[model samples]
Target: MVEAMAKAKLWTSPGGKRPDATLYAAILSDMRKGKGARFKKPAPGRFMGA
Candidate 1:
């Protein structure tokens, strides 16, 4: 099961800050193994002084 899912691609937020290629690859690897998707923190200074 894990192997099958791993074959599938992982998705990332396009609007998200530029992510490290290696880190993204790792996350995708994990997700493919049935691990939950990783959520990125909100972009810095997005709501500053709100």
Candidate 2:
């Protein structure tokens, strides 16, 4: 996934910018992946009231 993203030109930053395209892309990708996994269904009886 990282390789694919790196190759897609999805990451971009202005010239002389503090953050390069690769860094921005990585952070964005990580944020997206993190959000995707932030919510997980609990197993039966795992919660206070199953």
Candidate 3:
């Protein structure tokens, strides 16, 4: 799914092809592939619910 999204040339939107969506898809794709290290999962019990 991430690969498909990343390979897409454009994201169809009501406003037409959106580069923002493409950028987001690319980010998500990278994260899915474990390449994004800037963002890390919060430690357990750090959240309000926990």
Q: How does model 2 score by TM-score? A: 0.29
* Cα deviation of 3, candidate 3, in Å: 23
For residues 1-50, what per-residue lDDT tens digits would candidate 1 score against the true structure?
A: 22333356443334435444544555446545433544332464221111
CA lDDT scores, all candidates in order: 0.41, 0.44, 0.43
Models sorted by lDDT, best on top: 2, 3, 1
Residue-level lDDT of model 2, residues 1-50, one tens digit each, is: 33453489754444444555555444545545644533233554221111
C-alpha-based local distance difference test score of model 3: 0.43
Top TM-score prediction, candidate number: 3
- For all candidates, the clash counts are 0, 0, 0
| C-alpha root-mean-square deviation, candidate 2 | 11.7
Q: Write the per-residue lDDT of candidate 3 for residues 1-50, one digit (tens) a residue.
A: 33453469433433437656654554445445554333333554221111
- Candidate 1 C-alpha error for residue 25, in Å: 0.2
